[model samples]
Target chain A: MKGADRSKLAARLAHDVGKYVARAARNMPPRGATPAMVAMLATDLYSLAGGRRASAVLAELAGPFGEGDERLATARSLLEEADRLEDRLRAAEPAAVERGRAIALEVQSLVLDFARMVASR
Target chain B: MRRLLVIEDGSEYSDFARLYLADEFEVTTARSASEALRMLAAESADAFLFDLRFDRAEPGTLVGDVDATARRLFGGDRGRALRYLQDQQGALILAELRSAGHAQPAVFVHDFPERRLANLRQLYGSVAAVASFDARAIGALLSR
Candidate 1:
């Protein structure tokens, strides 16, 4: 990929991940996101930014939400975990990546089921 | 008298709920989740009515010029504010109740985004019963 394309890809990834983080932190019901989901999201983000700029992107998205909010607190914690996991996966072999994918799918299933229930009601 | 807890951040809505339900049920009001939990600990209420959005937003937030991207994602100021509350304090009182092992009392949410009701239920593990701010819904819930 050319320099410009790479930058654009990084930007898009950051923007999309930031939105999901915001949704999970701010809009997702409490207890809705499991630790695995957080980890997976972080992994995706870490890969997209090659672990260096992921943290900055997350901070930009979640930093403005203010300090006392619980959602913000959760997002911050998740970001830290993602950062750590990103480092660990890089140092070791990429094992948790597959597990994280399964967890993400499970989370998606739960969300879909909930959405269906809501639609029926 | 059957006891009722009204968890609303708005004073006018709290007062209206108290007056409206006072004749049939002993209505107690709390302006925040913390207050509501304290009240619950002090006395066992037969039912609860919760306002979806509480007054928990940080000051100086909703006033600034929002970026076009944010506005597109979350809509206007009110929508953004409501989303914040729902994410932070939404269904908190109910979560507390469930955590306390109290049998789910006759509970209803007032003025919540209907679209997100299922989301709340997903977090709390039960369908959210809807309630209006009016006396009629209050009476009906308590009557059942």
Candidate 2:
């Protein structure tokens, strides 16, 4: 059985979302989105801002986590980090967008390793 | 023989898992993600065991990246980052498997004692079972 979890899609960006806080965190005047929610939007941005090759990770790296109340703060912070990470990908001149995907993949592998630790438990 | 693949990094709990599960399943345990991927490629294990932490850093990557991303998100609703990481792992594993050409393989998450299996079932349709990392939980998943 190799289907993706419909309940918990990897968000193509972040993945360590806790259900508790997402449910608990609420907003009166909700911002754009939470850190968890905007992870997907970030994916869209990563794709559109950089284009197909740059945002190739549109499929696997959508991010996750955070709450409704924390959407703006979360989105802003992640967007900042994404920019820095993109800089790393674009190191040594203007790099291809897939460079970010490569970076995301490598990082995701580590995440997978850590996940193995928990599943074993 | 029932086939099961356990991907672990030599945790004490993994040993308990083998002790408890070896009798019931033709258990094949791999200590690394690569090893597990190989076994999965060659075998149709009924279940998969995934852990969200590792000691050895992966080639061409740093632990800080995943850690930083995890901390920023995965707080779930309660701000418990680690638990959030593990839960997200459940989703990622299945996604990778699908990309790799596997059908809907039943997944068992044994890390959360307080976290009910139903919660995962509600969130992730493919989750077969979730328990406090006990043999009984594994058994229940396999039963489905």
Candidate 3:
């Protein structure tokens, strides 16, 4: 696409930061949050990669959520896995960052895949 | 007291559930699946109430958005991706549960989407009894 189109997509994704993060303990539920929140989180990561195409950004998640599947349960499992692991770490309990980060990575991948799916769809 | 485990994702519905079921069962609440599993791993609970909507713009939506975007990208044939999304969520839930080693657990839920209970049942190798805890009255009856 054109440079402006690419820039707009980034802005569209990056536009909402606060609502995206939702300041909730991984142990806390995200019922009050929306799909937009997750979308923004995905964008934040994409921005770090710098000038990546939307499809390129979603490389990690293309297999699962990237196809517009949103597999809520799978996503939930991934999200929960991350949250639980982190909660243990932050609370000074026996935390496994690797395990949690693995889950987070899955989520990040899924989110990127999702963004690509959205753009492609 | 019959024990109840609430696995929610930090949403209004989770509290809604706790409020209704707390009267009858010894309710232990976990906003995320991981927290719920933590409780489960640590102790024994009679039943579980899991909220499938874990995070906002959850994986499910990502799938849908991708499908939509792909349709735009390819200019048609979006159904395949949508189908994949529907099946994958159930697969993940089952994987998570089995990986967590939850036993023949009865589940109470509202939005499981993609009709995963069937797969969940098959994975459990037997039918897991499921109930709707969406209404206070129904929850009251089920908790009994």
Candidate 4:
């Protein structure tokens, strides 16, 4: 894709990811989310990690913008962590939900950072 | 550049403004109503930008009395009242700003329903809103 198109897509992804992270944070943790709630969050995180959309787009953009981009690298690693969190959630681990929430917050910050990078470009 | 004051519970809106609106606006940010008021008292701004949902804001920093709202609207359910306050904190902050005699135009990046949007305009003069973080659209609203 062209640079302009890539930037647009990055912005859109950042917006979507930020919104998802906020919603997931609200539904998790000290609010006393149920096991089913954690499962649902895990399912969505699975999609965000390697499913057809977000990961593919991130990989494509990484080719052009990822070089020497610490934020992009961090975002990629965090997504990998998200994937692991999903697995732990599937196993119904005790601390997995809280861990997922922490990952979601990190993802939210990185999404904003990604948007900032795209806007600067 | 016009000075734009952004108020939100988190840094997203302010970060966007700095990254995308920097050429058109000199951005200032506040994380709560009291902070915004203090900033306004120190300097003037050409416009204001608000984030509608403040789910991450500290409870004490949030506007509106949770107890009062619970009694009046939520059958004394403080949890529900607290959620309502977080959901509507942006508007509450704007109300405080208005009461403080700041009449600058205020903009929000939210797609409020028609009636709700109308109500906001009715309550707060010089209010504007767009549905998303399109920089050009936001700049236009702020410039207006």
User: Which consecutive 10 residues in model 3 chain B have the weakest lDDT in total?
Assistant: B125-134
Compute the lDDT for candidate 2.
0.41
Query: How would you class the docking of model 4?
Result: incorrect
Q: Write the per-residue lDDT of candidate 2 for residues B41-88, one digit (tens) a residue.
A: 887777665544332323222212355555576443323444344434
Q: Model 3 segments beyond 4 Å from truth? A: A1-121, B57-94, B111-116, B125-133, B136-144
- Ten consecutive residues with minimal summed lDDT in candidate 4 chain B? B11-20
User: For residue B88, what is the lDDT in candidate 1?
Assistant: 40
How far is each candidate from the true structure, as Cα RMSD in Å? 19.7, 19.1, 15.7, 16.0
Off by over 4 Å in 4: A1-121
Error in Å for residue A83 of model 1: 56
- Model 1: chain B TM-score vs. truth? 0.63
Q: TM-score of each candidate?
A: 0.40, 0.38, 0.36, 0.58
Which portions of model 2 miss their true places by more than 4 Å?
A1-121, B31-33, B55-91, B104-124
lDDT value, residue B117 of candidate 3 = 63
Q: Evaluate every candidate with DockQ and list the scores.
A: 0.01, 0.02, 0.02, 0.04
> On residues A16-61, what C-alpha lDDT tens digit does candidate 2 reach at each position?
3221111111110133333332332234334332343223332233
By DockQ, who's the top model here? 4
Q: Taking the tens digit of each residue's C-alpha lDDT, what string does model 3 give over B22-75?
A: 566777776544555677788877755554433332444332355574576546
